[model samples]
Target: MKKLLTYIIIGSACFSACKKTEEQLYTAQDNIYFDLNFKDLSGNNRRMDSVMYSFALFPEKSVDTVWLPVRIAGMRRSEARSFRIAVDEKATTAEAGKHYKSLEKEYIIPADSGVAKVPIILFAADPALTSKSVRLKLRLVPTEDFTVTNPEYDSAKVIFSNRLEKPAWWATWQGELGNYSRVKHELFIRAAGVNELPVAFDAQVLPKVLFAIRRFKNFLASPISWVADNPQEGYTLEPAGAGKYNFFSITNPGKKYLLELNPADNRYYFTDETGARIV
Candidate 1:
């Protein structure tokens, strides 16, 4: 009998506390924070004021959605509540409905939920991404239902681009591919459908990569026309063995250069009078 009385007293106190909290929730102010994180293709973990996105990494994707995580500081009510967010036009470089989709009329924190996401949609179709990057800056707007909270997480910026960079592992292809160039890297991505080669290197893509290499070689060797046009002044290249060649000077045949792929190691150099390597 005593234990039953104690249970009833504890249950009554819990009910009173919940009722009090329910009453205070309507009077208290709710706040929303623009919490964001950066998860780029670099595979590094970091906390940043801005998020970095690249369309180059996802060549096939025409559009990408970046979620702006928002946190509610106040109580979670039973009824769905709407909040507002605004983009700072002065600080933003990306245009609405062009570079990125416009924000919705309002964002909502569903009933009994303390978190929500505001999406910033980016379009890779913009030619600007190919030459330069664009930035979308957003901040929480205080409305009747919710107020902006936390200075650190009050604003979020997303920097997106389609610019290309040389892969760190490009040195591995020197012996086979000869040298690195911007045009070559661009061709490599189109052939491999990837920004960087995989560590294991899938054998299936070898033929496509070889095809791309052949195209690169054709581009570099296109001066066959110029040489033919100016045969008197243009030096003629004589093929040696094993993809190696001798560039004999047209005016001074005594001077020759070994046109060779040194695998990025200093092995190719000017030849002596006897066509022997100077080094």
Candidate 2:
């Protein structure tokens, strides 16, 4: 009976301990993480600790920005909240201001957002980057507003350089801009304001395209003037109307042939009264 009582006491103690642990687990705080496995401006998702950047890709830009993503693993709140990040100086090789702009004291995760991005501003005008790459490491610090749950994503790194090199995809776009040269590439970046073509256009693109179409319609609606090359030979070409033409022939005074300009090819061709092309 004494042994039985001892077993009951031990079992009750174990059950109580387990119940306490389960309650604590249920009440554990939701946390934020860097979500290193994320997508950037290129829209390609990569699981990496460090991101690489080059200023040469945007030669005309004095500064550039790339967004690093952070995510929350639990329920979102109704209001925006701030989080903390700091430069891990010992792990960083890039200089502040010269290599990269200083980060804000805090970043915001909008209300109801499961994910957020921290913008990393990189200096493109640094001459040293042309010769060597510099590194910047940023650590996610726990604050009253946020706490890091995963040690793996507690920090992120970026390696950057100003050295310009022709992108591999240049092979596909070279013909559109002609041969690639340092000067030409810079000009292309300046003119286009982007390193790559925008493959996916949003709603804003439609209005500009429509505006261009309107301009083109105005051009087509306007009359085109063509002069008879040999006016001395009694050949006079005048605009009759769209699809109709009048050509004055001296030899056959009553024989009228319509001369029309093909805007598609910017060439002139003669058509008979029946609208058949005269070869």
- Candidate 1: misplaced stretches above 4 Å? 1-26, 37-46, 169-178, 197-279
lDDT of 2 by residue, 42-104 (tens): 999877999988765644355778889988776687888888889999999998988788989
Instruction: Judge candidate 1 at residue 80 and give its lDDT.
Output: 89
- Model 2 clashes, total count: 0
Best by TM-score: 1
lDDT value, candidate 1, whole model: 0.68
Worst 10 residues of 1 by lDDT: 270-279
Q: Residue by residue across 68-182, what tens digits does model 1's lDDT show? A: 8888888888998998888989999998888898899898989999988878888877766777888988888888888875777788899898666666667755655655654
